[model samples]
Target: MAGGLTRYRHLSRSSSHRQALLRNLVTSLVKHEAIHTTWPKAKEAQRLAEKLITLAKRNNETARRKAQGILYTPNLLMSKLFGELRERYAERPGGYTRVLRTEPKDTYSQAPSALLEFVDSPKDVRFVMTAAAVARDLAEGREHTEITQKNVGKVTRYRAGGKGAFEDMVEKVRALDL
Candidate 1:
């Protein structure tokens, strides 16, 4: 018998186990900033990577442990997650990782992949601050400083000759228009 054998340790796992495994793997990848694995593994890793990044948007213990629970290796990942990744992904709203195929000329290369490189561009906040300012201004009773444009659609009458309040008003307005 094979002593201490762990054949197919990463693969051949149950669906739930596989999902958890991939989630942990990708979570660690995001925490550490980079990771390498088989092409198919990388695909699964991307899924987890995006999820972890989304979680990173909210830096909290619950989110951290949620990510940790899904991961197989938590120490290395935890360090990178709380230290580098937490700050690096602060301003990014979502969409954390990108997968790129590595090998372009070989058969194995047919399934190659890589993740989107991290960049430190915190100034690029994905929020429309002006919109919020406008809302605040409106709430404060400030008049709209700019002309508002609107697309007025064609009006159709459902009960034109009926004795409804709207129909009565329409008749009055039509009579006035004449």
Candidate 2:
């Protein structure tokens, strides 16, 4: 089985159960714009979330119905999904979700945890972190490093007025704890 092609993670669940679990995770992702879970679960859910956003972008009745099937409590989230989220990603092609790995969330299970979020949404931590890094570099009179510049580019690439928004965040971060 080593180095073989695998279509998707089974997550040690039966097919129906796996579908339901991913559906619930995707629903929560839509409602909160972010979630923390085991890295495997996050990656699986990221795939579902990305496809769902693509459906929203399509903006058709059939797509709406398909989206409804995937999203629990579709009535509450559909408008936001088809409206706000659709507009948010209107210009971009793909890769709407970002998953960042972290240390184990709890000591017992010791499972690797990750944060999954839509890239340009209000809950984007990378954007905030980039601003903090920039502000810290400025405070220390250091230049922005290559990694920081790369992060800056990624966080700002598809966001509306992203450069201005990041500049504003840098100022806010600079003003704090300085």
Candidate 3:
């Protein structure tokens, strides 16, 4: 009866256990923007993270409620999703997250490892300044350094402060010609 439907990877978990695992993974991914795990687990989590981001892109109350249902903790994550995350990926068609295979810590283990992260996340936090910082710099007419480094594979730019900081920084930098 369930024929033709794609059976998702079980990751050797029961229905409830798997649901709980995915929920926690989604929450962690949203809050931290990145997580490291074994290949199979990362792949499964990536699937769910992308879906939640897509839902967030809608940015309506219904979409917010739907995402809240899937996420484990709703307040901060839901706000981030509906606000900054929604704006960041608005132009992108899909594929809001990425899975990068990584070297395993233990060479003896056979399981592959991977890093799952949102596409917009930054690699280094120190390299970025918050919107408030940018605003302060502009208001004070301070010299601001440009982002000279290029993003390597799986190494995206980091956002300082919290919500909307990265976007705000970019806008200020552009406006100030800095």
lDDT of 2 by residue, 33-149 (tens): 999999999999999999999999999999999999999899999999999999999999999999999889999999999999999999999999999999999899989999999
lDDT value, residue 64 of candidate 1: 82
TM of each candidate vs. truth: 0.47, 0.96, 0.66
Which ranges in model 2 have alpha carbons more than 4 Å from their true place?
1-4
RMSD of 3: 9.2
Per-structure clash totals for the candidates: 5, 0, 4
| Candidates arranged by lDDT, highest first | 2, 3, 1
- The numbered model that scores best in lDDT is 2
Model 3 lDDT-worst window of ten = 148-157
Shift of residue 32 alpha carbon in model 3, Å:
0.7
lDDT of 2 at 36: 93
Expressed as tens digits, the lDDT of each residue in 45-111 for candidate 3 is 8888988988988778898888989998897788898888888778778877878788894678867
The TM-score of candidate 3 is 0.66
Better of 2 and 3 by lDDT: 2
- Clash pairs for candidate 2: none
